[model samples]
Target: MRNTRSVRTHEPSFHQSALMDLRRGGKFAAVFLVLVFGAMGLFLVAALVIAKQSIPDRPAIASPPAEGVGSAPPSGSAAAATGQDHRREQLVRFLTAAAHPGQPAWRTWMPAKADTSSAFVYTPLSPADPGAREAGPGATARVRPSALTPAQTASMLEAVTRRGSVRPSSVAVSHASGRASGWTLDFVVRTSGGNWLEGRAAGSDRASGETVLSQLTYRR
Candidate 1:
């Protein structure tokens, strides 16, 4: 008999193979879950950014003006007209007070350095009458305008002032035309005694930039 050597091959055990398969399956499952969750998170973040970009920005709201306040100040001719009206009102108040020195209500209206010595002219024209008509070639000679003495002007102003005092609200002033220089103001005063008294007062600036009364007239 020849000497024979037999070689035995050993196969892996069932327990070891099962353990290796379990570890491989666990690793693959973990990697798949991680990829799925990461992709979903990135998608959600991108959707949020896209939505925010698509929305428009809102505009700012303007606040409203306060009570009794206007949107804008008066300008141009409107401002000038407003100033002129204020000056005329001041003149009316001044004249009203000067005409009646005895009235306590008008005392506050008189200025400290008011000058009333200037010449005052009188006319029969009504305060409501339009500007003087131009003289026609054949028209009769117009009567010359008369100057009032200081005493007469004072008396006339007193009468007119009394009329105005009866109803202070009835006193109104307007612009008088036909004056070449300076400003002429026409005023109407209603009295309880009888007809309304109409008057005209003119003023001009002096060399010292002070306003001085140039003329005045009043009639029933």
Candidate 2:
């Protein structure tokens, strides 16, 4: 009797080997593409960080006012007040010198160095009587050194005797209107008779912004 069981033979075929190789190649290509995309993403992130660090901060500028509106600049009143105060102090010094008999007090009221040709006008009055003649340029150079008359000398001496030393604390300064640019200084001194001697000094601080004495008058 013939054997009815059939025996299977094992063998490698080119078609099956080619199919297995193709599957392995496809898996490797997928892995390589994934790695390439991941590296590209990392490089992009790094480049963005470097660019951010290279930029510098900038300062903010103020915006200008709208059209037709104006921005207020710094006021000159403060500077004017300061200049007036300084001039007041100078006038006080002049008054102090005038209290003496022979000192050229008129010179003190003038600028240390005058740069202008404007004539200075100085007028000295007496406390004894209003009829006393005013002394200054064109009338008499009594404001100069050794130019005081016997009566004027006596009047100054009597005033000093009646009034104590000048008090710079009582000096005051005011602005003069109707002039282009000028100021008025008011001076006060305490008297032994408990009275107050008043003096007014008016002048133009003009001539390239130089302080000068143009007019000075004193009364009791």
Candidate 3:
């Protein structure tokens, strides 16, 4: 009798089959999750890029101007004119004060070094009293026949007592001819005696560089 080898068929058990199915299902779930998350990340990146390109650029802002940039100082001629106007105004005030009644007022306008030898000539334009004889154009009165100082002139003027007040009007000032720093003024004043007085005054600088009255004459 020939020896017959028994051929046994090997088969997997139920537990092993169940374990293999579980492992295959787990791998399929992991692959699906990875694909979904990767697609979502790509979509987010594309959306950000498109948004950046659609936005408009902002405009630049300008700065303010510096201090004192637009304004300029006065020119030389303008400054000179302003100085001349101021000097003229000062002279007017001085003339007004000099004609006023009191000795104190006269001193306020007179400079400290005023010429002691200054001359004052007066011509009558109208008589103090209507009945009195009117002086002719050529006739004049030298209030101070001798060379009198400003103080002496003021005292002499004060001595001629008059009833009404004195005030200046129709004043005109001009630059002296051929003299750079000289000025001449012409003015009319209503005297304390109810008569009109016309006056001319010229100013010059002294040796000590001080401006003082060189000539002062009046017509009444």
Candidate 4:
């Protein structure tokens, strides 16, 4: 029998025909270019959105003792005026509540913090002297919560803060051994860069001329 080559099938599946054509470069290049551009566009859009979100939107809160308090106003600045007013209000609120009502009628002046002000009132209600112990040998002399001799209070205040107030917000009551008692306040209050100060009370023993122990030095 004469052998004959089997007739090959002419019809190919749609996928097979498509795969055979992939060897051609133009279509594949076009598809790859489209995909590349689309990815790049997405990346660019994402970067733009991120760039817009990185900025801050609000002003910062100012600190206490900001410039422009208790001083002459600058010629034409709204910002300075606002700062000055705020500082004044803070000082008034703080100092008014801290007024003294004793006999000597002493008050705080030249607060180490130029941004703030303080005042006080007093009564000779101290059960005992607070500074006697700390003022003892080797201890620094300071105003006591008990009836303070004005001279003693002044001396201690000068030693600590280099300022003086006839009245203070709190009192210093310590034991004879330098320990505070019954809400004993630290009368030897100092500034961050200044010495401690001793303050006087409001009232006084008229005959003794000594200030009654009502108020003393402290931070709170």
Q: Give the per-residue lDDT digits (tens) of candidate 3, residues 67-173.
A: 88657777877655654554445445555655554545544334444444553334433343221133344454443223445544554443222222444343444
Worst 10 residues of 3 by lDDT: 124-133
Question: By TM-score, who's the top model here?
Answer: 2
lDDT of 1 by residue, 1-220 (tens): 9998998788779999999999999999999999999999999999999999999988878788798668678776676565456545655665556556444433332222343433333332332211123323222112121233444434444543553453445657755443223666777766667557776766654445445455555653
Winner by lDDT between candidate 3 and candidate 1: 1
Worst 10 residues of 2 by lDDT: 136-145
Q: List TM-scores for all candidates, in order.
A: 0.37, 0.40, 0.35, 0.27
**CA lDDT of each candidate?**
0.53, 0.56, 0.52, 0.39
Candidate 2 clashes: the total is: 1
Model 2: lDDT equals 0.56
Clashing pairs in 3: 125-220
Model 1 quality (TM-score): 0.37
Error of 2 at 205 (Å): 2.7
lDDT of 4: 0.39
Candidate 4 RMSD computed on C-alpha atoms after optimal superposition onto the true structure: 15.5
Of candidate 4, the 10-residue stretch with the lowest lDDT total is 174-183
| Model 1 Cα RMSD, 1 decimal | 15.4
Quote the lDDT for 65 in model 4: 75
Per-residue C-alpha lDDT of model 2 across residues 164-207, encoded as one tens digit per residue: 35554566544433232676666665544555666666766655
Please give the lDDT score for candidate 1.
Answer: 0.53
